[model samples]
Target: MIEIRNLKKSFDDNEVLRGVDITIHDGETVAIIGESGCGKSVLLKHIIGLLQPDSGTVKVDGILIADAKEDVLYALRRRIGFLFQSAALFDSMTVYENIVLGLWEAGERDEVKLRQIATEKLGLVGLGARSLLDFKPSSLSGGMKKRVGLARALAMQPQYMFYDEPTTGLDPVTSDQIDYLILSLTESFSTTSLIITHDLFTVKRIAKRVIYLNKGLIFFDGTPKELEQSTDKTVVQFIERFVK
Candidate 1:
């Protein structure tokens, strides 16, 4: 389980997350939705140790993350996989190489085992052995790169997956396909997911629970059914705009 207590952060003067408190249980797909600059991404970064909160605590599976020791932080990171907004694959490496890079960087130099696992990860994302393993990230289409990114994230068999705006730049059909892939993979692997998105369709399709943030506060936290029936004007508007 992941828990945030009284989390707060600011950039010099502008506060982003204001005394935020939330808890996400295992095997749950929780979507965090808010307007731009609402600090949704900031929350995800805190969970991953990319950003530290000015005050409060972030605990993952009983480990304190906000201010963990370096070794502890590294250990925590190994258990989580992050898919960035841009896919973040290396331009010079082949798709297979990209997937294996994390393992290599972690000091796993057993080529035979790495290759086997990388191949399995590729297949998990609906890619075949014949998929261009030698082609660099620059050679792949947008959707293909996204798939490769997903495969890389899965290579570690992370207990948690963090997706930042998974559907931002895609067409409707492609976005839905990505959403389905995320939903299917999370269910099949039983991995906890924290998705930060403004996409309501993606939220309705994949989120088991939803958190609506406004002006740096959690306006609502509940199941999708509850979200759809919320009565607050802001919450109601968000639901109508996205969940409908």
Candidate 2:
């Protein structure tokens, strides 16, 4: 389980998060939604130990990551997968090479085993074509790059997956496909998913629970249905902007 309590952060007097508290149970898919600059990405960084809270506690399975030792944090991070907004792929590397990079970083050295793992993960994301394996990120389309990034994340077989704007630049059709893939993979792997997105369609299709962060605080927390039906002006206004 992930537990966050009284989380707070500031950068040179700009307070981004204020007394935020949230809990995500195991095997649950939760979506975080807010306008840009509401500190959604900052909160995600804190959860993965990329950023330390000024004053608060973040615990993953009872291990306090806020101030854990390097080795401890490293070990804990291996169980988490992150898909950056831009896919963050190495343009110089082939698709297969990129997929196996995670396994190699985790200390796997057997080339044959690495290839097998990459193949399996690529298949999971529907990018298993032999011809595509040799292609580089520079040669793939935006949606294809996203799929490759997801395949690479899955290469680690992480228990937790974090997606930052998973469908930000894709067309509606591709966005829905990515949403379906996320839903299918989470159920198949029984992994906990934390998604940060502005797309209400993706939220409705992928999120079991929705969290609205406004001005650094959780303005609303409930199911997607509740969010749509909410009478709270802030929630209703936010939804109306994208839902119509």
Candidate 1 per-residue lDDT, tens place, 59-135, comes to 99998996689999988898898888899998888988999888998999998999888888888777765566778
**Model 2 misplacement above 4 A:** none
Worst 10 residues of 2 by lDDT: 126-135
- TM-scores across all candidates? 0.94, 0.96
Give me the candidate number with maximum TM-score.
2
Cα lDDT of model 2 by residue, 121-147, tens digit: 888888776557878899889999999
| RMSD (Å) of each candidate, 1 decimal | 1.5, 1.2
Which pairs of residues collide in model 2? none
On a 0 to 100 scale, what is the lDDT of residue 176 in model 1?
Answer: 87
